[model samples]
Target chain A: MSVIVTPTTTGAAGAGDPTSTSPAPGAAPGAPAVRSRFTRGPGRWVVLVLVTVTALAVVAPFLLMLLNAFKSPSDYSTNGPLSLPTELYTQGLTTYWNQVNYPQKLLNSIVISGTVAVAATVISLLNAFALGIGRVKGRVWIIGLFLLANMLPQEALVYPLYFFAKQVGLYNTQLSVIIIFTVIQSAFGTYLLSSVLSTFPRSVLEAARLDGASRWQVLWRVIFPITRPTLSVLLIFFFIWTWNEFFIPLVMLISNSTQTVPVALATLQGDRLMDAPTTNAGALISLIPCVIFFLIFQRTLTRGVMAGAEK
Target chain B: MSTTTQTRRPHRTGTPRQSGQPRQPRPARRERSYWTYFLPGAVLFTAVIAIPLVYNIYLSLTRWSGIGTPKFVGLHQYTRLFSDELFWTSFRNSLAMIVAMVVVPTIIGLVLAAVLFDYLGRRFRGSVVSVLRATFYLPQILPVVVAGIVWGWILRPDGAVNAILDAVGLGSLAQDWLGDPSFALPTVMLVMVWVQIGYPVVIFMAALGRVDPELYEAAELDGAGWWARLRAITIPQIRPETYVVALTCTIAALKVFGPIFALTRGGPENTTNVPSYFAYTTFFKKLDVGYGAAIATVLTLIIVLVAAGFMVFQARAERKDA
Candidate 1:
């Protein structure tokens, strides 16, 4: 519920400095470690093999899930969860997919996550505009409040939120989740984005102001363009984080029609135990979009992960 | 980290140029209108965070069951908490979580990052090093619940791990990992270790990148072993990141819920129960919303105290380095 990790120092993440961002360690890595390539011949291979094995171990569960997702229940039972499927049996996939209306869950996830991303980024920009660029009085206390909000576990807030949603007729609606997550995710966005914006040059703002640019105009025309990259990073993160969320959605969206992917899968446990193959298939399906996102945004993600942690 | 904060600290309230007669009329008007920009966020924050926090804290002082009305229980819930054995177990599990999420991962991540950055990185093809780092970090990118579900599948009684054990004639060692009372918490801890390894690795590797390459070179030239170099240079160089990782992960460990929900739901006689999960069940399953709020209040207080302790420790550490 509270997995937001940031570089303790504010300016380090979005600062326009080459040395701060994490690069592929294999590609250039860093410099001046003279004769870094070890002269210890066979031992180096040992290290490489050992590291590769560890990596494989780290990813082994996903591999097992993938392999078994295509297996028929009979294959799993007969072969005892070890053998390759005699044939591609995707019935488990289709069965589980239809059973929980997987496509609906997928759509709900996409809609809720996407909406939260864009909306949270906008709110974060607005907040940062005041604190970072506008330099609002008592900004430190405000930023600290947002940070505390980010760190406060959802457990502390969930019951009241659930009660309120019911009172407002939002208990089972996607809009309820969106509203909650947009605010929560932006709590983090505000913290990180404000840190980046605090260093915004006075000269740039003054130049825009001298051009008769209104505060809104300067924000949209001047600051937004400059801060687009940071906003983009926040957008991607909010989408992924919201998609991965569990507890609130679990409590809020009880019906299958309203449940998101992970929540749907968890509800499967509540009713009756799913067969091995169906569970595997469901798990695999739930992770595919995330894996694809990882592949596509590898560089941005790699950069962003280090951005908040390195500084 | 200290340097950045220190430089920003002096011009706390307003800019240095505003020292005498303040700023120009245009600037002054602009500054005042900044409150408008803050209005939307302020409104949202109050509704979502501020209100709920105060409401939950108030609820902690009463007894409610999600119906009728909440009766004022005074400090009874707090007193009951002192005697609740389940409460103790939940906290004990949190300590174990800290071990799984922070202590072990940070140690392994430090070694792995060092080996990757210092040894395998320069010695081998870049592809191998990059591939390994990505693989280690792969789990970090997933919804932790998704990762937990997969591990649940693997560790089931007749699941992949047991099947592998049978295939290798080690079936005797196979057990129902999550179903067993004793093994449930440890199995969950082990799974958490897998889920957490990547975070520290990514942070530390990035921290290691900033280490002056000349320092490693100098140590090597002086005939220092890799272990010696790690102790003297690598650890000290990345101490700030270490502090960040420890602080963030400790709070995260204490707040852990998604994985417990997906994998065990604090089951098998509640051995794997955490305070977060306990609060959750008390609220929804057991219909003890007030007790849940009390539990939440306790957890939040502990997190606050722990975070404050870490900040003080970090400040002292920075002062020593200075």
Candidate 2:
């Protein structure tokens, strides 16, 4: 939510804004006066209605999924998809969960996303350290290279990676996807972190160095503490991104035990055993963690997005 | 090289020996050791990204089926790709994707961001604005496969959308959204629009933050309408971000795979086949490795060109703005 309100706060006009030409009633100094076009009566209602309708439309699919997921197959067939469920039917969830080995799939997703997030963040920190604070030669070129790597489609690299994983006997293992994503996710991380680090205050590093801090110590003790916020944002993003990854994991982690939640659910699409309610249940289960993450880190995720766009 | 090292050696040793004298270390010399920090990332990038990219290109020039020696066939796959009808259809469908993912979303998002910034933030409570934005953005947080699953069910013949359409007495409009050739691509496009709209809205809202509020005030003082002000000030002010959003979303549109995989699998006469899915199925399902690489290479080229074009436009726009 600060995502919406932040623009006003960060906008040019503020409480201390010295450019207050005409003060409005009970507003921060220099804030826009109430004379704007749509702020008046009737227009405000129109805008509110439009925005609310659009938001409801945006959420319509989720509502449909939720409604049907708990509806029994018999209820759905008799009354159609839009009707209310007769009871709290949970057989769909249990059937899909048991069929897909939900716990194992969740574990696979967690292990892969968790490992990739930490490993990628660490790798990116090091990479950014060299390119940003160290001001390494060809830093611009190197950062550009990382940016390009991030932009390249997974299709371009999937086959070769698949072939290599088979050759190296790492196919069908969660570790393969973990390692692959660590590099891929860190590409963006390095790009973002390098840009952030490039603008790091040189005086702080100089102070640390003068206090007898070695290069490694400066990285750990000085830079790490200062950049923890950005790093945490990157960590959450990496974890979620890795969890949501599909193509590579679909190709590499082909086994049931190794497949992540998304890959597992996706493979069951249109299967003989899957009912409408079962697919909905599976999808609902898969996105529960993501919804939870969104609720908890709404501010952080939005901040990261802003940071990325600005970068 | 020897002479240069010899000249620098005494300066380095002398600096270390003079550490007790409160002397500053040569920043350039200190930076040299940081090279070691980049080693692991470099190796990983080379193996994961660079090498695979180059190898994929190499494989595109050869004939292989994921087994045996890849026999080098000069320009064979490229020629085959040029003649492939499905390949042509896939690229053509990418246009639909661009409209859904880039063009429509950007327009709607710009206006929505303006509303949130210009009207809602000023009129409503902060919580209201936040809740509205979150509702718009909720789909973005879900995995694409989850989105795919949810939309797939909703758009099914017996699904909620059709059921609602029937109940509303618009039964004639109800059809098999994903299974039919005619409606599949457009339905998928609609889903893509939903999946993508929040991204630009969020980014543009942030862009709007950096905009000068006084512009709106100045325009209002001149009696400009809301749309007039948005047109004259907000769009021009955020052209840079518009470019960024367009480029990133276009690239994502071209590279779309998961939604297609989960929703339609490029079925109903392959009407919804985009390049990424085409390449994926060709590689894995059909076992046509070289052709898959060719498809991926073509898609990659198009994306790079689009990105370059967007950046050049952004640069010119920024220059004009400045």
Candidate 3:
């Protein structure tokens, strides 16, 4: 995501000096190359077609799922798997939705993942402000610790977390998964934001502080407004991740009524082996939110995907 | 990335005028107390991850059924783990996943990215690349449960793969992909490969954008073929991205869960069991909490060490480059 640092208080205050608070320009080793027009040919068409086919092959499963979700079970079994449905069928979808308590599971997913995204963004923003802009003592060590924590596999932590959740009486509830996802996700959020915010000018904070602003005021008024792009990127990631998260919810949310969409769909998959259309419908339902989010925020999502891998 | 860290080091720790702090203002000093800003996140972080990590270590030393109380039996679980045939099988399967998920995919991704970025980049519209990248990355974005279920449908005996095989007059080649002991692990690994190749491809394409076109042009002018340019320029230029992709992919390979849970459920005599799934089944199904924790602990230790190794190598490489 592009870090647009708008000077909210004073647009004229060194606004022309782009380098004042901008993080180092990302590693662009060269300008994009111009292509010779003559590069197009029969040979290029072959390569283009091959790449197009590969792309289609990769996305074929998704298309197939969506298509099959519209078919009757008998139609699915009798017809070619690749064929279009003779008629749109909502029976399987309606049944699957009721079977999994679709509304409850979807709401649980939204509430849990939404809570995680907001909470993680806030916590990490504040933490990153401290470490990145506040320049706290032992900041390097703190960042290192966060990096180490981020490295641990979720599997290792979940077993003990299960017991811990039970001890604290958050077990089998949405709050339990929400808290865990927030904490786990914020570690990366802190790392990414801290690195970006470390580039913030001390003069900016001091300017606000000299006006008798509190720490929170300076953060809210000065630093945060400029970093909203990064925060939004983090929010999108945490939302998508917590939404798609399966393992933790599977272990923690034991009750079917409390389960998230993915967990509910997985459970349905296990029990409904003979019900292909219904299973496909459930899978389609689980995929819709993510697909919609992706379609809407493709650029930002792609940027976030590359941002973590950049360093 | 290196530049940001380096430039921030000297000016990063405290306020700008704190070098000779004999006359520092009291208010400024008080305002610099940023530790409190860290407390909330730190507290929650400790509660959620750090504390549980320590508790997991302690739990690994005992034998418990996850019911009443864990019985302290020092290293017994670890000792038994080494002799357990299933654990080794799972561990081996996890390693095999590294080949399918990490090694093969990394190669495919790098090659595919190069072809897209260097070859087709000039001829194709930019949207072509973007749309293609999105398509490739669909598997990574789709819930693993959905990917697993879809693949399950595709690979069933009367499923898409067999339907295609029969259509192509290779009916003898069709088989029960997930149910057979011999093909179960490999089929699972293949699906994983499909799911994983997208990530590296997308990341590698981004990395390629940062690589200087001049270097490739210079190499081409010297009569270097595509392979030569890829070897001498693209690979070295994208080494950091390669390392990051490799490290993350290996970690992912080791910790695979949802696909196994959804597709095979570690079936056909545990052929497709990975450590993470094994840990899950042991803790939940078998009710062996301590044993599960031990398995998870070992898995965590391996992941940590491997990650540490990558970091150290990156550091040394940076120093050498500098």
Error of 2 at A272 (Å): 4.0
* Tens-digit lDDT string for candidate 1 (A186-231): 9988887787777777678778877778889999998897777667
Candidate 1 positional error at B208, Å: 1.3
Evaluated at residue B190, the lDDT of candidate 1 is: 90
Per-residue error (Å), model 3, residue B69: 2.3
lDDT of 1 by residue, B223-281 (tens): 89889999999999889888878998899899999999888989899999999999999
Lowest lDDT block of 10, candidate 3 chain A:
A1-10
Q: Say which candidate scores most in TM-score.
A: 1
TM-score of chain A of 2: 0.86
Task: Give the candidate number with the greatest DockQ.
Answer: 1
Q: What is the lDDT of candidate 1?
A: 0.82
Error of 3 at A206 (Å): 3.5
- Per-candidate clashes, comma-separated: 1, 0, 0
With candidate 3 superimposed using the best TM-score fit, by how many Å does residue A290's alpha carbon deviate from the native? 0.9
Model 3 C-alpha lDDT per residue in residues A1-311, reported as the tens digit of each score: 00111111111121112222222223233522322422536776888789889889888887878888889988988996777899999988898888888999889999998999999999999899898877678888988888777778777788788888898898999999999988888888887678878767666766676677878788888877777666777787788888888899999998987999899888877876547788788888888888988786665644543443443
TM-score of chain B of 3: 0.92
* Tens digits of lDDT, candidate 2, B31-134: 43788999999999999999999999999998999999998997999999889899899989999999999899999988897887667776665567778877
TM-score of chain A of each: 0.87, 0.86, 0.83
Better of 1 and 3 by DockQ: 1
Fnat per candidate, as a fraction, reads: 0.49, 0.55, 0.50
